[model samples]
Target chain A: MNFFRKQSLSRWLIHLWFIIFSVFCLIPLVYVISISFSTESDLAVDGYRLIPKTFTTFAYKYLLKSPDQLITGYTVSVTVTVLGTVLSLLITAMLAYVLSRKDFRGANKLSFFIFFTLLFNGGLVPWYILIKKYLFIGDSIFALILPYVIMPWHVLLMKGFLSEIPLALIESAKIDGAKEWRIFWQIVLPIAKPAMATVGLFIAFVYWNDWWLAMLYIDNEKLIPLQYMLYRIMNNIQYLSSSIRPGTVNIDISQFPNETARMAIAVMAAGPILVVFPFFQKYFVKGLTVGAVKE
Target chain B: MSYQTKIHNSQPLANMNVKKKNTFWREFLRHKGLLALAAPGLLFVLIFNYAPMLGLVLAFKDFNFRKGIWGSDWVGLDNFKFFFTSDAAWQVTRNTIFLNFIFILLTNVVAIAFALMLFELSRRAVKLFQTTLFFPYFLSWVVVSYVTYALLNPQMGVINQLLTQFGFHEVNWYMEAKYWPVILSLAYLWKNVGYSTLIFYTGLMSIDKSLYEAASIDGASKWQQVRSISIPLLSPLITLITLLQVGKIFYSDFGMFYFLTADSGALYATTDVIDTYVFRALRVSGDTSMATAIGLYQSLVGFVLVVTVNYIVRRFNKDNAIF
Candidate 1:
């Protein structure tokens, strides 16, 4: 819409600005992926080279020496992401559907009740104590799943989507003698597919990127998630060398995947998520567009 | 709703209006299935969210587990006093507010500028740039910490190597506290700019295209159009976003600060915020009480800030107020 001449100085300057910033934004990923493939000797010799001087699989090989931790971490993360996304989507959609109903007398009250949670909160220690002591879900997988399942912001966004579906459709379905459950499953759910895909990706990403819950709640080695494991290793390399899983033989510090292996592990931890990014790119933008629309 | 039963029965409105008193009850029974479906989620929020607002009382107590939450001795204002009186109090408060202020201002300007820039590009170029820019937002901070380490590592980091090539001595980025403020701000901008860019872009897209055409016909230059139309129209949404940001002034992005710094105590002077401080109090010092106290302080101030800003917005422009 900036209808300046094709060869204008501002056009070239803006293009240069965006091109530079895009590269700057990508450098973290480029550097990490590059170092992950670099030979340990080359990394030590060159010190964070942009492209690997001598590419090798040695870092990944050494990092996988104790395959149990990596496998368990992935297993925990994938399992939780799958289960958590489904549960969160169902609960959020149902609650939003109810709020979307113009006929439901409690809709306004319920909306305010849910939205109020976003403003005020019980401080972390109390919430922590609630889950850890009162609920007794401590060290269990439920600790990770329960806290995030009812995100109010997602509920509000889903309501916006549902509200856009013509009210007459729901009324017509009900007048045809369909049950509420049938109407929701057959009529509403299919119409709201785009919204579901967007929120599903959002919830899945939340479950994937979480390390805080695992750090706070679980002490069990079997339950450690990928991000927390990456965090421990990256925070201190010595932890990687020692028995990350107790009851296993302790490795000497010198043989640890001390440098290259650490970066390699970071790459592996983020591997599946990054590969899935392009697939969900459209849906993610749609979700943000939903927010912009509501505004 | 059962209030519409007369319509289904093909009866007159006079007949149904007499029985309107029972409408709510009958409607409740009629929609029992939907109500049942919504119960679990309602219960979940009740237990997790609203229930904890009561636990803010732990901020006043000694937090003895044996005594339990209700049974603990009341030590009113002691914890709050301790938080404000602590030596690290002012520094942490300043860091939290200052960092958040800078992020709010910087992300808005950069995101809006980038959004305007995206508007000037071809469709293919916009898509390509959008993906690359959004990539970092998906990465976990733990991975990013290693990325930061690669760039800032004392001996073999890319920055040091670049310095050496320029005929200057290498600078140790981690040990120094001064460099972290700039680095952390840059990191925050990198992770968030893509999301904000999308928002601003959507806002720009929603504007009627014919307006720009009409402006050009009237001999309005590009800058004039942007200043008169784009900035004026977008300012309300921008202010709303800025107010939402101001609400979180007392909070910090824990992962960004904790992970990217690699938990180097040397840099804590410039980097630590209230959230990290509370986390350290909980983990390292094993003082849950102190942690809860600081949390209550942060939440109270934040809650007040959000409500007050929202009230001000509502008074002026009812359409833009969040609540």
Candidate 2:
């Protein structure tokens, strides 16, 4: 009876700890969301709050009033993410499928060729110059899409998934005179749907969340993605805040809805992924766990 | 008679050469479809990955805008000397290694602990906790910076408001270099720990329940079962993740360091890392040659570390070795 009590106590303790930590994880996001919904005057007076004293859509309304930049950012981000994800998935799956075939000559060598990139690269300079100078891809959509298209890590993850299908499955198809491409399309792809979703979501996230490529290659305002847009807005805010004198009492930062609007932009930029990911959480967990353990 | 013998010997030798060539060609014809499937990706990799590798030679060249990579004047060791002699070199290098070491150590310990705790829960409870815990991981560092700003904003930030309420002096979180190491680590954990916790939880789930039952039957406590069965089994994974992180200690997550600090020049003392430093040198300072040199240094050291660590891992567990 004492042992049972002790075990239950510990279990309850775990529950309590997780609840607290989970709250800790969520507080920042909750605070930001709350501030985004609150009016600028309330924010200035109350600072940031987990719950707003008064709720208004003033910030979001302000953002929507001049939604040209926001619209362009959304359109570009969505276009690149969708295009990049599909193309990356196809390319990665094909390469991985080839390497997954034990019967294929040079499979091991080719696998090593892909894996070596994960270990080392020429670093940022050559890569930047190659795309910018040699390829002339700067300020283009391809600049964003091309660089991340054949991520070595994703290729390997897909390879790990693909190699698990039985060789006899492919052999029987080959016996029926199905070509390698046909076998890959007809037999392999349908079975690899879960892995595809997992890897595709990951690739999509990379394309969507990325600002690094844009920062380096993009100088055109029209080409900026959502994250980079958010980055710019935040950058300006930081500059504004830092440039002000510490002792100035008369300057009201909130007179312009910039503070609340920045948070709203952030919320909008990050909102879609947060909303979409929960539905795919199971596959996300499976992919990450399997990838970690298997690798 | 000699002429006839020479002709006879040469005839079979010529046939043998043709046969050897035919075998290779036949094999190529057979695998042509597979090669076709791989070609697009192979081409991309060659351009994006391999081309830059060849372009590492730019590290030794004085980059002239009008002159291309091939036509640039060779200035052997000068770019490297520029990087090594700079004061930023030691600072960034030390910060990268030290901070990554702390992050790996702190986050993994916390993750493992959390994973163990969750291992004690029921399925429904685990699901609920996981949903909330993993929420932060989806936010980009750019967004997280906004969240960070809301807290650390000098005047009207929440922490400052709270500090004044408690009769303590408000902290200027952004300007203070001393606070960033802790702040960054906490931010790192907030965004990352859940992913790793779930990983460790998955690892823990794979452990045989029969062992725990058998231990309990022998009067072992839950703690004993964990220490004896769980930790020992989980060590392989923990070691693998740690060693993998150690391999990339030279590279910081540029997004985190860049966005969270908002590239503040004030906090560069503690927060500047090799990656951010390289970016600033290349873009902000327009010192392409020096940046390339630093990049080369990072890549070579990173490669050696990864290869060495992989070798060490392979010595014990072949499957665990990344290569």
Candidate 3:
């Protein structure tokens, strides 16, 4: 009876610790969300409050008033994400299916060809020159999507998932006079939906979060994605205050909500993706399981 | 020969002949739809990945704006000499390797602990906790930088505000090089603990439940069961993660260093790493050749590191080696 009581006490303590740790992970995010809605004056006075002492959307309002740049950034990010995901999924699935086949000649060679790139690469300068010279992808949307598509890791994951599908299905389809194309498209793709969603979400996230390619190949202000634009805005603000004079006389540097604006841009940039993440978490878990366990 | 025997033999031989006549091109054309499916991905890798590989020659050339990459004059080892001779080389390399070593050790320890704790929770609670914990992984470094600034900013920052409120002097965190190694590690842990936890959790889940059941029957305490059963089963995964990290020890997380430090020169002593050092040398100083040289050095070292590590791992356990 005493031992039973002690066990229950330990269980309660474990629960308490779990709750505390969860709060630790979540509170900072909650703080950012609340501050995004707080008035600038209240923020300055209160420092960072858990709850908004005085609520206002002025930071968002300022951003919305000059919404052209923000909207363009959003459009570029969205287009790149969508196109990149679809293209990446298609390629990953096809190559995965081909490589998964038992009798496919050169499958091992092709796999190695894909895998070698993950370990060794030419590094940044050469890669930058390649994109600029051979691909001619500078200052374009392709600059964002082209570099990220078909990661070797994702291909390996997709291949592992495809390998799990029974070989009998392919053999039976072939016996029925079904072409390899028809067999793959009709049979293989349908079964690989979970893997596709997982790989697609990952590819989409990479494209959405990317600023590296933009930093390297993209210099035109109009072509900037949201993250890169936010990066530039931060740098631009610093430049304006220290280096360049604003072209207009009426604009006062002191009135600008630099701190609040930085937070607001962060909220705008990350908000939609965070909203979509939970829905995709299931697929992500499945995808990660295959990749992590196999590798 | 008997008629039935001859007919059976000829039928099997005819099938083999048909299979042999199916050439590579014919089989490839037969799978044209699959080829079409592969086209976009192949094109993407071709344009982005493979094309970049061809540009590696630029490291040996003086990049003249008028002459371009191929048209430029060959500079031989001058670029490499500039890189090796510079003071930045040793500092950046040391910083990269040292910081990465600390991160690998610390992150693995915490992640393993978190995973163990997670296994103790009930199913419903585990789901809730995981979602919350994994939230930070989705955020970019830029956003994470803001979170850091909110805490560390000199004037109205929360840390400073709290310090002054406690009757302590507020330190200028941005100007101090000493605080960054700790701060950067904390930031890295906060952003990544969830990912490592998830990986470790998956490893835990894969362990056969029967082993734990048998251990309990053998009069084992929870701690004993974990120590004997769980830790042993998790060793391979732990090794795998560590080995992969070791391969990239020469490279730094550029976003973490660049954004969190806010590119302040004051923090360069403790924080400047190979990637950031090269960025400063190339973009800021307009020394493209030196940057290329440093980049080449990093790549070569990273490649050799991975190969050496993989070889060592293969010696211990062939199955776990990445190759």
Candidate 4:
């Protein structure tokens, strides 16, 4: 009877600990969300209160006022993310399929070629110079998409996933006089949908979150992606004024809602993905489990 | 007459065979669309990843803008010489190694604890805990900086508010260098422990359940079962993650160090690592050659460390080594 009581006591303690930890993880996000909705003056005075005394969407309204630039940045971010993810998934799947095939003569060599990039990289300066001088992808949308298209890690994930597909499926399709492309498109891709979604979501996340390429190769105002724009806004308050001029009057830098604007930008950048997260959550977890084991 | 002529014209038949071989070449040419699919990615890597590798020679040269990279004056070993002689070099290198060591050690320990706790929980509770914990990993450092600001801001921060309410003096966290190492490590663990916990948890799940049952039946305590069965089985994963981190120990997470500190001069002593140091030196001074020297230094050290660690791991357990 005493042992049963101790077990129940321990179980309660564990449950309490889990709840506390979960709250710890969530409070910062709650603070950000709350502060975003709070009046700027209220946040400045109160310092990120859990419950805002006065709630207002003034910060978001101020942001949405300059709808043109925000819309353009959004469109740019979405286009690159969508186009980059699709191209990357198709190419990665095809390459992975070829590499996963047992009869492919050069599969091992190709796999090694892809794998070697993960180990050694020619550090930042040279990479910067190459993008600027040789590729000349500077100040273009291609600057974002081209440099990050084929991540070796994702390719390896696809290869691992493709290896799990039944060989009989491929054999039967080949026996029906189906070419390699048709067999891959018709049979393999449908079976690999979960893996594709997993890898695609990751690739999309990378493209969406990318500001490194813009930081390095892009300097033009029009070419800046959403994250980079957000970064610029956070780093330089002057950018907010210059980019989002309401009229001929120069807006006071002090009056430009800095703190709440930062939170609002954070929401705009990550909020869409977070909303879509639950649907892809299962596949993501599975992918992470497999990928983390190997890495 | 035609039939007899056809039988006699064996040379024409040989030409026809050669023509068939030529048609094979033509077929390959006609399928250029297949190869075109790979073109954009191939071109990108070649230009961005591979071509930059050739510019590594700048580390060996006295880089001059007028002469360009290839035309730069050859000053072999001087770039390396300047780097080795500098006092900041050792400080940055030491800071990088020490910080990474603490991160890897603490992150793994905390993650393992969380993973064990998580595994012991009910299925529904585990999912809830995971989603909550893992949410931070997706947030950018820029956003995390804001969160940190909210916690540690001098005047209106939650901590300060609580301290004042408790009759304690409010501390200026941003101005203090001594408090930053601990603060940064805690922040690092908070953001990353979820990832490591998930990794360790998945590894735990794959462990055969019978091992635990057998140990329990043999009068082993929960602790003993964990020690005897769990740790030993999870060693490979633990080693792999540790060694992989060890490889990049020379490179700090640039975003964390830069953004979290908010480029405060007061915190540079504790916060500056090789990457941040290089960024400051290059951006402030515009010394292209010196930046290249630092880059080369980091890459060389990182490469050597990875190789050495892999060798050590392979010595103990062949299957577990990264290579």
- DockQ, every prediction: 0.51, 0.66, 0.42, 0.30
Off by over 4 Å in 4: A1-12, A102-106, A237-257, A291-295, B1-47, B209-221
Sort candidate 4 into its docking category: acceptable
Leading candidate by lDDT? 2
| Model 1 lDDT tens row, B120-235 | 77767777788888777878888788888888876668889999999999776866888888998898899889878877776676678899999989988788888888877676
List RMSD in Å for every model shown: 5.6, 4.2, 5.7, 7.7
DockQ ranking from best candidate downward: 2, 1, 3, 4
State each model's CA lDDT, in order: 0.81, 0.86, 0.77, 0.76
In model 2, where do residues sit more than 4 Å from their true spots? A1-3, A245-251, A289-295, B1-30, B206-221, B314-320
Cα DockQ of the candidate 2 complex = 0.66
User: Cα miss at B277, model 4 (Å)?
Assistant: 2.5
State each candidate's clash count: 1, 0, 0, 0
Model 1 residue B309 distance off true place after TM-score fit, in angstroms? 1.5
TM-score of each: 0.89, 0.91, 0.88, 0.85
Give the alpha carbon lDDT tens digit for every residue of B1-323 in model 4: 45534744766765676666655655545534333433554555566566777888988888776677798998888887887798878878878888888999999999988888777777777777887777777666766777787688676667788898899998878678888889889889888988789878877887899999988889887778888998888888888778778878888888789778876667877888988887776567777777788888888878788889999889989878876
Cα lDDT of model 3 by residue, A236-271, tens digit: 665565353333342334355766767788888889
Error at A116, model 4, angstroms: 2.7
lDDT: worst 10-residue window of model 1 chain A: A238-247
Query: Which candidate, 1 or 2, has the higher DockQ?
Result: 2
